[model samples]
Every structure is written in C-alpha cells, then in structure tokens.
Target: MKKLACTLIFILLSCHLFAQDETHPFTIRGLIYDEKTNERLEGAVVSSGDNASAMSDKTGFFQLRLDRKAEKLKVKLVGYEEKNLVIDFDDESEVKLIIRLTPEPILLQGVTVTGEHFTEEPVVNSYSIHPGDLSKVPQFIEADAFRAFQALPGVTTAADMSSQISVRGGNYDETLVFLDGIPVYNPYHLVGVFSMFNSDILQNERLYMSNYPVSYGGALSSVLELNSKQGNNERIKGSAALGLASAKIALDGPLWGGNFLISGRRTYFDFLTRMIMGIRFPYYFYDLYSKYVYPLSKNNLLTVSAFYSRDALGLDDDKVFVAQKEIPNWGNLFLNFSDEYFLKEKSSVELKAFMSRASLGVNTQVFFTDYYHQMGTTDTTTVNNYIEDFTARLTFNSHPDGQALAVGLEAKREAIHYDWNIDETDLNGMYIHPLESLFFDFAPSQYSYSGDEFYLNAFVTDKVTISPVSELTAGLRGSYIKNLKTFLLLPSFSFSYNFLPNLQVHLSYGRYFQNTYSLKERKTEAVFTPFMATFFPEDKENIPYSDHYASGLVLSDIFSEKTSLEVEGYFKDRNNLA
Candidate 1:
C-alpha cells in the first residue's frame, strides 16, 4: 500500500510540472503617451486578446500579465484612436514598450463626460462636481463655484449678491472648505461676489452634504473639497480672459523634469472705473495660486501648493470737511506640502504638512478741522482678528481583496488673536462694527482675546464587502486637546444594501465634534471672531457636538440612460450652541 501511494504522488507531481511548462508567465509593462503632444495619458485601457486588462495610472504607467496564447494587445482611451501592437516575446518573462496613441475627433456630438452613473453605488448625500460643467452655467461676472452650488438640492444662497450658501438649514459657517487636502477657513473674495478658487486652475470639486466620513472632522454640516490642476508636462500653454469685473491669466509648462502651474486673477473694475471715468473705485480684489508636482520614482510623488487672496477697500478725501481715511481689508493665505508613496498590494502612505492664516480687520482715522481749516482732534480706531493653523498629518491606506483599511495620525496647532478699539459708533457715516448692523440688541466696546490650542487626533476606518450586493463601513476617532486637558472618542457607521439591480438603500450614523465656535451675540452667525470652546470654563462638559442619523434611497437607470433619482432623510441633534 505504501508503494502504491508513492507512485500516485509521483504521477500527480509530473502532471503539474508538465502543465506549468506549457504556459510561461508573460507580463507587459509600459507608459502611454500622446503621439502629437507627447503628453502622458491617464485612465487609458490596455487589454490583451485573452481578456487580461489593466488601466493606466495618473503617471501614465501600466502593467499587465497575460496568457501565453495571447497574440496582440490593444489600447483604448476616450477622445483617442485605438492602438494595436503585435506581441514579440523573447526569452525574458517581461516585455517593456512605450505606447503612443493619436487623438481623434469624437463622432458623437454633445457627449459630455459627467462622472455620475446610475449603475454604481455612491456615498450617502455626496455629489461630484465636474470642473467642465461650471462654464455651462450662466455667470454673473465669471464662473463661481459657490454660485453654481445654489442650483443643487439642499443648498441655498443668502442672496443673489452673495455667494455664501447654507446646506440643509445649517449656517454657512458650519461648512468646512478644503483646497488641495488643506483646510480653508475663508474661501471668499469681496465678502461673497466671487469665490477664492480660480476655475481655470480647478481640476475637481466634491461636496458632502452630511454624514461625512470621519477622515474629515471639526464640521457639523458639510464639506467642500477642491483639487487643482497638475499642469502640462509636455509643452507650455497659457490662457487669458477679460471679464466685466475681473481679468485672469494662467500658465503651465514643464519644469525641472516635472510640471508647474501658476495663475492670477484681479478685479480690473477699479482700474476701468478710474481709466474710463474719473471716479476712484477704492475696492478691488486679487488672488494668486501656484502648484508644483514632481515624481520621485514610479511609486512616489511630491507636491507643493500655495494660495493667497485679498480684498482691499480704501477711502481718502481731503477736499471735504471732517477729513477721514478708512482702510478695510481681509484675506487668506496657505502653503501646503504633500508626499505620496505607493506600496505593493494596492496600498499607499501619504504625509502632509500645511500652514494657513486667515485675517480680517479694518483701520479708520477721522480728523476734526477748526474754522481756519486747521486739522485737529484726530481719532484712530482699529479692529483686527487673525487665526493661524499649523498642521502635520500621516495617513496609510490598504485595500486587500474584499476589505479596505485606513489609519491616520494628525497634529494641529492653532493660534487665534482678536483686537479692537472703538470709541465711537460710526466710521465715515457707516457702521464701524462688522456685526453691529446684523445684531439689533448688541453693543460693541473694547474687547481682546489671544490664545493658542494644540490638538492630537488618531483615526481608523474599515470598509468590508459583506457580500456581492452589500457593504459596511465603520470608523473610530480619538482626539486629545492640550488646552482643555481632555480626551474624546467618536464613532461612525454606515451600511448599504442593494434591494435590486437598479435600487439601493443606505443608512449611516456618526458623532461629530467642533472645538472652534463662532462668538456672536444674536441668533445670526458672525463670519469673524471665532474662538476655541476650550477657552471658556463653562464649555468643559459642553464641547459642542452633534449626532447625525441619515437614510437614503437611490434609483439608478430607472428613468433614463444617464439619469438617477435620490431621496434622503436626516436628523441632527446638536448641543452646546455658542
């Protein structure tokens, strides 16, 4: 019996070896580029005749393993002609080829590339904004993202003159804005006419109405995140536009084996009014944006971005009595650095360092002249508020088979300063205090506050595929505030089930916390003078938290080929109102 068993094992081993010899491991690796421009193309599909396929990454690199029986490979990309190459295998197991595809005019007209598809399940209460669609909407002066958002459901603007929007009954200040993975406290120019983001430099925008992921914190209402363009690596390109209120120019080109983009926008209405008419338009706004991208290697990338925007209004008239000079300005500045390293087995690590400052203030001087036209009794009033944030974060993400995990550590420090000295009620016949007109039953006086707070946060999230038609996501976050000497844990959960091929239901719950609270006297929210809740002793137990419960139903491909319907109900319980 022992001899018979040994003979069977030897026969099975010989058969396995013979099968291995019949099929050799074959792999193809290459980069895809444009034939005319020599620019790298991302999202191109490469496939072998035997059904093996791979997609090009952002860097236009792809790798595919195919069966030995496969003879030829084909590449297809939108707006480009299909390319075919014959296989010429040598003794080596791997083959490298640089492929180039020619651009072709699409036969179909009015074929827009909207990212939304009815067949795929999406996050609850989330919307993706295509940068190209912004131009289709009517523009007040130029394309404004915030203005475009007003047409979306659950979003409402304050007025036609203002671009500020409220989401689902939440205050405008409750919304958190991010640019290039960094937080932006103030993302407006001229208080609301135009957003700080330049449409020419924007690549993508996403809005999360509610029940957002724990990866983003310190917000109770919504999140708006924007990503900038990566620039052209092959050749130099520039564009300029003239508008009624503003003028903008953008330039992008290859630099130092990488790419760079720079853009600037300034309202020329001040100059036009002065040049055409002899009137002095003292109010104008300008903003500048720049970014640089470099690839350290095939799997590593480095990026740096900076943004600045300012709105300045100056008035000085010595020709009239009671000569007065007033200057009111506000703006935001931020610098961000990010490094991403891709690992094996569909994993990556991201490290980010960011610095940002938001400042708003006004300085006014009034002079009383004597009967002889001699200047006397000069009074000066100043009000200034600034918030500076320094942050460093490291995040790791892995997707293995049917599950995904994300863990991150973030350290943030914020320094807030407020100063004001006002002796009178009016400045050049206008309200001096920013909120004096909004709040009916309030009085403004000397007030000052200066302090700093440090926060350490750790978060972990897991997404698991329960079955072919269901998914579950759960997350936990822990935060420690040094000034408050407190530690808190927050948990979130989400579940989605496909009732049918075209219908889906999603349920989610989350607990959110906010350390920064606006200081206002009336029911209305103030745009400036934000204070940390930790500064007040009474806020120890009332750290300003909210519990969110939401459920949504999605119907895809029900009405039309490219149409979808979504319905959602949500409830929010908020505490510790400032």
Candidate 2:
C-alpha cells in the first residue's frame, strides 16, 4: 500500500512538469497599406522579436506568431519608412492590426530618383515585376506583359515580332502561365505580339525559371504567375486612356462592404491602318475583365473573377483581284471562383474552381478563271477548333514555429475538338503562270478529331531555415494522367545563402513534365492556326520532361539602395519534345 501511494505521487509530479514545459504562442494578423493613398502594399517584411517573420501576400495580408516572451515587432520594405510596434500579448492570445507606412523620397547624389527600381529577396531563381514599372517600357504603343518578360535574362524570343518566349532553351509551349492561381491556355493576342493580360489590372507578377515550388506542375520549362488587384475599399475611382493602337477604361470601387473592379480594352488597328496607309488590315482584338471580392469576416474572403478576349481578322475581296478571301478568328474565356478561410492567424485553407475555353475558326475561298475556255472554278475551306478545361484546387498553408508548410491537390478535365473541310477544283490548265497555278489547289478532304483528358496532381513543400544566414526549400509533386494512363513524379530543391548583408548566392535543381503539345509547320514565318495536340501515353513510348540546374549571385544596394543586379546561369536537358 505504501509503494502504490509513492507511485501515484510521482505520476502527479510528472504531469505537472509536462504542463509547465508546454508553451502557447500568440498569433498576430494584420494588413499593411500606404499611409496617404490607402493602397495595400505587397512584399512588406514583418518581423516579431528575432525568430518570427513573414512577408505580406499579394492582398497585403500578413500573419506572425510569437512566443509569450516577445515584446517588439518591426516592419520594413523598400521605398517605405520603417516602423516599430510594441507587442503585449498573453499565452494563447490573438491580435489583429492595420499598419500604414509612409513613403520615403529617394535621392541619388542630390538628383531626384526616377525610373525603374528593383529589390531582392531570398528566393532562388525567382523574379517579380511591378505594374507601375511596365508602363515605362515601349511596346506596340502600349505596355505588354510578355514583352517585358522577354527583356529579362534567360528569356529569348523566336523573332523580333513574336512575343513567344523560350526560357533557358525551352520551347514556347513549355512555359506555364497562371492568373489568380488558375492556368491560362492561349494567352497571346495579335499573333504573339502581345499578351491578353491588361497592365492596368495587374497587381503582382512573379516568374520562376528553376526550382519553382511544388504547388505548380504540368509544365516543363518555367512558370509565370500573375495576380489582379483588388478594388479600392474606400472610394470610387475610374480611369480611361486613348492611345494610337488601343483604348482602355477601368472602374473600381467598394460595393456591399466588399470591392469590385471592371476593365476593358479594344484595339482599332484595322481602322487606323485604313485611314493612315490606305490598307485594310482587317484585324482587331478586345478583352474584358472583372473581379469581385467579398470579405465575409476578418479572416475569410471570397473572390470571383472573369475574363474574355477575342481576336478577328478578315481579308475580303476588296484588296485582291484574284478572287481570294480568308478570315481567321480566335478567342478565350475564363471564369474563377475562390474562397479562403483562415483557421488560425498563421494557417489558412483555400478552395478554388475555374473554367477556361479557347476557340479558333478559319474560312478561306479562292477562285481561278481560264481565259481561253471562259470557265471559272472555286476552292473553299473551313476549319474549327475548340478546347475547354474545368479545374478544382484546394490548398492548405501553415506556419508552425519559423518554418512554413504547404500542401495542395488539383483536378483537371480537358476536352478538345477539331474539324476541317476542304473542297478544291482541278485548275492545272486554268492559270497562265506556275506561281499562280500553285494557289489553285486540286484537293477535296474532310477530317474530324476529338479527345478528352483528365489529370490529378498533389504536392507538398516545406521551407526550413538551417541557420540565420542559410535557408533551404524541398518539395515533391506527383501527377496522374488518365488519358495517358501514366504516372509522374517530380522533385525540386533550392538553397540560398546570404554571405553578406548585400550579397547572396543561390542554387536550385528541379524536374518538370508536360502533357500538352503545340504543333506547327516548320516555316520561316510565324503561323497562327489550330494545330495543338495532346499526348496519349498509351500510344507514345515516353512522356515529355525536363531537368533544370541553375546557380546565381545577387548583389543588392551595390551603389545605392535603388540599384541591384542579378546574374544567373542555367542548363536544361529536355526529352520527348512536345
């Protein structure tokens, strides 16, 4: 009986010691904004004590968790004044705040600073572009997103007039583009002269050339992610611009305790060409965008976004006397709905659904006449192509201690349809010259093809800090293709070391895969047609994949705070060309 009493007393003492060792951390959530303009600020750094730090997201939201013993917080960002706050919180407590930072004027040797500015972070092989800086570059009488990307290192274009970028020796179709966490197919307009994205509506743009996070997949070369701005929460505002090539308008305001934005742009190139050069170019393009944001609560939000773009080109019998006419048109439509809920100050869950459709059509007619026989023949052709995609994705993010963990799952369904009809008469003796005879084809054919593909992807990524000056990121992605009946696994890793306050080095390696293929005729000039095809693994021996290796050194504030330089070298090995 005495021994049993002693055992019970020791058990009670052990339980008390375990409770004393457990620590309940405090969480703080906040939004950072510009003090005078009330605009949300992204990329701001928020640090609590010494071990906890977070950067503001595209929405200007930031979250930090700290131990009970922490007492101070600091916020810093480029072009803004640094601010410090006193923290007073108990165990298991939560706090919310709104911080406003004032802008600071930059002076370089007594000269007012103007032009492009750059800032460097710790992410490896990653770059970001601001919308304000895009307007400074000259491109087709308007700022272009893709054109701006082409100016970056490791990115090259096929031709001077083409905006299709090939990154690190990868093909044009190897790059993946995303807008608001949704994939975008056929993102070009004006025969690859410009991108469909409107510069005025963009909030954030990021490019990952190598070792990108596992949250994104299904691409072999690179990733370009773009986010649209949330409308003004305080007041209503509108802007309109009229340029030589296009006209655009934007409206944004608060609605029903939320925010809304609408923007549209249209080009009048055909009309301008007819008036100035007496040439009926017969080509025009337009795009429309809308976004709605509803803040359900302090930590929950809902977003709905829609986009539409159209391009039409026609050449009737007005300009050519040979009785020839061709009309080609293409367009894209996208819709997305997303919901975000915060489970804790440093953890969140997001659910998103999106649909995208792309279409192409072509109609052509040609006629031939024989003077000796006084006879005429006609050739007509029609082609129609359509592609549609439906996708759903769920992502979860958590920050425990100083490390970050993210996991996501995505499902996609894609459908494609292509049909063409061609009817031509024998015109071998109708044309006088051999060159003219080549235009009068003698062929009659019809073909139709359809396909459906389903994809499932899951990924997990972790960011760990091994020391104060070094950080590492490890990720893995798994994907399954139903049509191909194949499974793929991709792995990514990156390491960054800050050797000095203003100098850093980074290394990264990753494996990537792609299931879609873009087919075009091997010609000297660019061709805009409906010739894209999908790969079926059952019929193919190998799937498309690429391995990337890159290393870079970044120098920040070499001469001044506004001056920064990045030099990177990369090697890529691609197999099973798409």
Candidate 3:
C-alpha cells in the first residue's frame, strides 16, 4: 500500500512539471503605414519583449513568434511615434494587425519634412539625407545635393572643380547613380562642378558605401539613390527661386483623379558673367522634369516620369588673340513607366520600364597667326559620342513567418556610337609660300564605331531573423552578357547583432563585377578640355572584379538623442582595373 501511494505521487508531480514546460507559442503578423499619406513604411521595428523582434520589409510587413509569456508588443521607427499593444496568446494561435504611425512634428520652425533620422537605421553602412539638410550648408550660389555628400565620412572628391564622388577607395566610374527606379549615366553638369539633380525637387537621398542590396548592380563600389516628390494630391501648390547663378520654378496639383508635378531650371551665368565681370562667357544649361501618378485601383498604382537636360559651352571666334574657338555640348533624356500591385496584405509586385539617352559633342578650332602678318595656320577637331539604354524589370516582395524574400528579373539593351574627325591646314611661309598655299589641298581624317550590347540578370535575396537581437541577409545574383558571351555570378552576405539597446556590431562580404570600361585622357592638361571618348569591353576570358570585406560598430544615442557614432573598416581586392 505504501509503495503504491509513492508511485502515484511521483507520477502526478511529473505530469504537473511536464504540463508547465509545454508553453504555447503564437505568431503575430502586421503591416505598418503612415497615418497621413497612407504610404507603407519600411524598416520599422516590431518587438515582443527583449528577445523576440522583427523588422518590416520593403512592403511594410513583418511577422514575429513568441511564447505565451509575452505580455506587450512594441513598434518603433524613426521620424514617427511609437506604439505598444497588449498581446493575449491564450485567445488565438495567430493575430493579424494593421498599425498606423503619426509623423513627429519638427521642433524647428522653418524645417520641412525630412526623411528618417540616420542614427536609427539598422544598416551600418547606409545613410539618408534630406534636401532641407543641404540648405543649412552654405554653397557657391545655391544648395547642391552632391556637394552635401562630401561632408560625410569616407567620401572624397578628386578636386574642388569636380563634383564626382569617390566612396571609400573606389574610382568615380565605380559608383552607380539612380533616380527613382532608373539608372543615370553621366549625372554631372558643367564638367562635374554641379550634379544634374536639383535640390528643390528632391525628396530624399540614400547612400550605400558597401554591402548594398541585391536589387542594385553594375557598380563595383557604391550606390547613390535619389527620390523626387510625388506631388500634392489635394491642392495646387507652386514655388519659385531666383539665385545668383540659376533660377527654378516648380508646380504641382491634382488633375483628373491623379497628381502631376512639373519643374524647370536654367542657368543665366552666360548673361550674369557678361554683365558683372565684362567677360564674354558663353555657357548655359537647362533641365525640365515632370512626373504623373495615378491610382488605377484600390490595390494598384501607376507612375510616369520624364526628364530632359541640355548643356552648352563655347567661345566664338575673335574671343582671344589667336582667334580660337571651342564648342562643347552634352545632353540627357530619360523616360520611365512603373506599375505596382499589392497581391496580398504582406506581398506585392512591381514592374518598371525605362529608357535613357546621353550624348556628348565637342568642336574645337585654333588659328596660329604670324606676328608680323595676318597669315596663319588653322587646326580643327570634332568628336561625337552617344549612349542609349532600354531596360525592363519585374520584382516581387513577400514576408513569410520569420523572413523576407525579394526576387527580380531584369533585361537591358544598350547601343553605343562614336565619331571623331580632325582637319589641319598650314599656310605658314616655313612650309610653303602664301601664294602657293592659297590653293593647297588637305584631307581630313575621320574615325567611327558603333555596337550593341544585351544583358539579362536575375537575383534573389532573403532576410532571416535568427533571434530578437540577431539577423542575417544573404543574396545571389547571376548575369549574362550576350555581346561578350560571358556569365557572372555574385554572392553577398551580411550579419548584424545588437548586444545592447544602443550598441550593435555588423560584418559583411561581397563580390562585384564590371564588364564595361570608359576610355578617356586623365592627363592634367586634359582637365580644362575634358572629353569622354567611348566605353568598350576588351576581349578577354575574364572580366574585372572586386572583393569587399567590411566590419563596423555602431553606438546610438551617444551624447544626445540625435547623436550617434559609427566606426567602420573595409578592404577591397581588385583585378583587371581600368
């Protein structure tokens, strides 16, 4: 009887302990959006306690699983108000939520709506800047978007006369520039003294020094992406500015159940310099930008945009004692159409088609006259180069239980044309008498080349949550070049861990490749008369590539809520550099 009672007690105690150990686990799924604009918010943090958390993806969706012991859930994002909710896993195994966050008002009186604060970003090597920030810095005549980047760490320019940025230790050509969803080639005006981007029309700008997302390619060093305003959909609004060097006008309003934005800028330095300095300066530039956004349905949106820019600089005859003349001109035209569809609450698809054309031309003539007489020799050279690109891309983004996935397919066709001509005539007596040279015969030399290239690329990236404080991102990209008959595979990975609420560590590795190279003179004498000759790929078995290794530590909220510090180190090994 005693042994039977002991066995029964032991069994009951074991059963109770076992029951307590089997705690119920439930999943929380949600979508976050802006309260005012109803636009999806990316990179928002959702946390359940300190050990369970997840970040929203590009589609503004996130999912987290936690045990029944979790009592409260919190959502936090920069430039927005935070929210907390009570969680009850006992009621259901899964809970779905839609969260709306209100934007925080700026304490400064004259400040506009800037993008998210940089210190709150989870990515260690990424930074965002707003147009309003550029206005605080004193520039030449007007604020410049590209010049603001020079104040950041690890960003350098070769000279003060140029606006081309080199991130880390990479060359100017290695950096990729993007406007909206389209690529921009030669994004500089006035020989790199100013960027093609206008500060007044910019909404936000992002810079990735290394470990960029797989959605961006073709560059070996860094990526610079800029976004323009989508226009006010409620009422008509306009702004105009007149600076010492240039003037700009912008207008936006609702039209036919959609919104439209139009802006234009022109430089008057040709007229200003001629009046103020009494110099016959003949240089001017102008650009026009327009965008239209329409809601096709409750779940779909369409966007159309177009941009055009032209630059001209020349010196007419008799401007100098030698009677020299130079006419250099360049221009860019871009058109883009994009469609976005929300397939589900946590999934979406986007399709985009774009075309870009850039052209450069130079015409130079020099006359060498005899000091004693008006007789002389003349030499003339002309160069013309053109590049055109057409691209189509489709991408899908989804948020599953504990991971985010992005898959994309892209196809591009590019055409290149180049032409060069030179003509020279010598009327000097040293070569021949004036009467004999009056009927002299000379033949000009000419060269021309044309080619077409095709490219196909596919990529997929995944962000996996290891734990509340740890996450991993991995991606693979494959590209095929039809003209070169070559294939390239690139792989990248990054891991981040938060040891404390304000301290984090990150490490990343990536392999990048470039198939096209530009040919231009880099001598100091060519700076004043700069010209881009052509872009071509050499005949070789292997293409140029670079391997990058980077690590960094971030400390947020250092001395104040708005202050942060980041220390990073990177090493790159390159082969077959151009």
Candidate 1 segments whose C-alpha is farther than 4 A from its true place = 1-121, 317-326, 368-379, 431-443, 520-538
TM-score of 1: 0.82
Candidate 3 displacement at residue 462 in angstroms: 1.1
Candidate 2 C-alpha lDDT tens digits along 15-44: 334323335466778989877556678889
Q: lDDT per model, in order?
A: 0.72, 0.73, 0.72
Candidate 3 collision pairs: none
Choose 1 or 3, whichever is better by TM-score.
1
Candidate 3: C-alpha RMSD to true structure equals: 12.1
TM-score order, best first, reads 2, 1, 3
Name the candidate that leads on TM-score: 2
lDDT leader: 2
CA error at residue 291 for candidate 3, angstroms: 0.9
TM-score of each: 0.82, 0.85, 0.78
Clashes of each: 0, 0, 0
Q: Is candidate 1 or candidate 2 better by lDDT?
A: 2
Question: lDDT for model 1, on a 0 to 1 scale?
Answer: 0.72
By lDDT, rank the candidates, best first.
2, 1, 3
Candidate 1 per-residue lDDT over residues 349-374, each given as its tens digit: 78999999888776777665567778
